[model samples]
Target: MTTSKQALPPVVSTATWQKELAALRIREKAVTRELDSVAAQRRRLPMTEMPDYVLEGEDGPVRLAEIFGEHPQLIVYNHMWHDGAEWQCPGCTGFTTQFTRLLGLEKFGARFVIVTQGPIDQALAYKRRVGNAMAWYSTANSSFGSDVGAPPDAGFAVNVFLRDGDTVYRTWHTDGRGTEQLSHLFGLIDVLPYGRQEVWQESPEGWPQAPAYSKWATSQEIAAAYGEDK
Candidate 1:
């Protein structure tokens, strides 16, 4: 059963809509340039030597440098995991589901993986439950998360590292919304009339809204909603 479509913006002639779209394009281009400038500055940031921390994966113990393999660049997603939670973080699971494959990153000489504070068996169990294909490791006894800016209580983070021979250096890191770059869901939502359907969005009056984080769901819940067996 399909739900009725929500009210839309006022209908206008093609020419009028084109004019409005063109106006918006100007600001979009400005944002594009600003992002380019910021990226350029980010590239020039100095690197810091990273500790050779060991993380636990399905195949027993592994060193941080080993994760990079033959690639010089490594991207790690620090997923949030409570000590005795029944499930992994919904936000992290959702974002990670967007990255079902990492073969494409190989072309750019980058390896991507996830690190969580949960135990190895628990992390692998959740991976199987969510059908995530990315390499996941446990930092339960390692300070790799905190060393890369994710405190024990922090939610999530994305850290980038560069390896020079056997030495690994931290190149960049971001947490919170900064990690949104890994997910395309928000980009699609931004184009919708209601824009994320979040209360904080600056939508027109009467537009649908919900409390922030209310839309989150576990991977199992999401799969079951879509009629996929888990």
Candidate 2:
């Protein structure tokens, strides 16, 4: 339902193009409505247990509640760790970079965090590279990510969890950049077959299209480039 934009021939038919544009608009609205309904369902879903599990953190192990800090509703991005030794996901990094713009979501009483299979230190290091001030932690040895319906093995998704007093609730969640169609990284997923399964950025041409861990890479390159050591 999406077109790869290209310069049209000078003799392009205006009426035909107008019809195409109208179709695109209808498709866009349908997608938006569908996503909104999903968001609403997410917001209405019951919350997960609060004091249940503790994810790995920079200083040490920390409970889920501790990550909340001053806010009750927390946005957790289930980041994918590179396979085996290479320990970071490029697509996940793409979403993290959006944090600088998402700071405004704070006004809605929600905070963001990234939960990866990598350790806390490694997550923090990558977060630094992306220049995101958002909160991050690792599910390294915890089931926090899995139990929340976003298993670490599941690659990536944006999950919003809400906490009201001692009770907590689950809010919105999104798996595709089609929802984040506004982001450059997510927008680029259109060129791919899966359309950003690990939806991150709509990167410009020549940037690493898909990031994957390779046993072929040198330890230094992997560590610096994909958080291999972490």
Candidate 3:
């Protein structure tokens, strides 16, 4: 498969390209600093007490606080679900699958997991279908998902929590593109010259374009792509 050279950036001398990249580095540093500042403010945001909702876990029912395991900090990705569907939310499935190894987060007292509105069996089935690596739980028996911003048949969300003994507090919540930070796939795509190729993106004329999210694969597609057993 050969890539088209048309609509690509103009060919440039190595010295000129290096000079342009050096200038871009300054802007990249500024953005990184701004992100650091934002993270600092997020750490200072006030938290609210959260109920000890019983979520369905693999072994059995588990309390919200127990979801943190030995960690005091927890990051939950509230994955979207469609009732009785074979395929779960493509965006959520794709997003969560990117985080296959999160054991390192435990060193910082953090545990990352997925909480979906689907039944435990269904959620786990999708997990196996897509070969998701993060621990997953179900909020089907409780209002945890809805109260936390992932209402049924709605959208996906990322919620941060802090646990003190058996008590848990909601520290932060974000959705939409705010969840993009956790997606290494999107981060990599954004750096590409064509940049996601989504129609909503501001790209140079004649650049490849497709509907936003058109590239995300369904659970079945992902399973086949990775040769996961169905």
- List per-candidate RMSD values in Å: 2.6, 7.8, 2.0
User: Which tens-of-lDDT digit does each residue in 17-63 have in candidate 3?
Assistant: 99999999999999999999999999899999998799999999999
- Tens-digit lDDT track of model 2 for 1-230: 99846433335589987987799899989988998997687556764455456888777887777777778778787877763544355555655655565567778777777788777777777666545556678887887777655575565776777776655556566775443643565456454544443225454443343443221234344345434233
Every model's TM-score: 0.93, 0.63, 0.94
Model 2's alpha-carbon lDDT is 0.64
Against the true structure, candidate 1 reaches a TM-score of 0.93
Top-down lDDT ranking:
3, 1, 2
The numbered model that scores best in TM-score is 3
Model 3 Cα shift for residue 23 (angstroms): 1.7
Alpha carbon lDDT of residue 41, candidate 1? 100
lDDT of each: 0.84, 0.64, 0.89
Ranking by TM-score: 3, 1, 2
Top lDDT model:
3
Q: Point out the worst 10-residue segment of candidate 1 by lDDT.
A: 221-230
- Which regions of candidate 2 are displaced past 4 Å? 1-10, 13-16, 48-51, 82-84, 130-132, 149-154, 171-184, 188-230
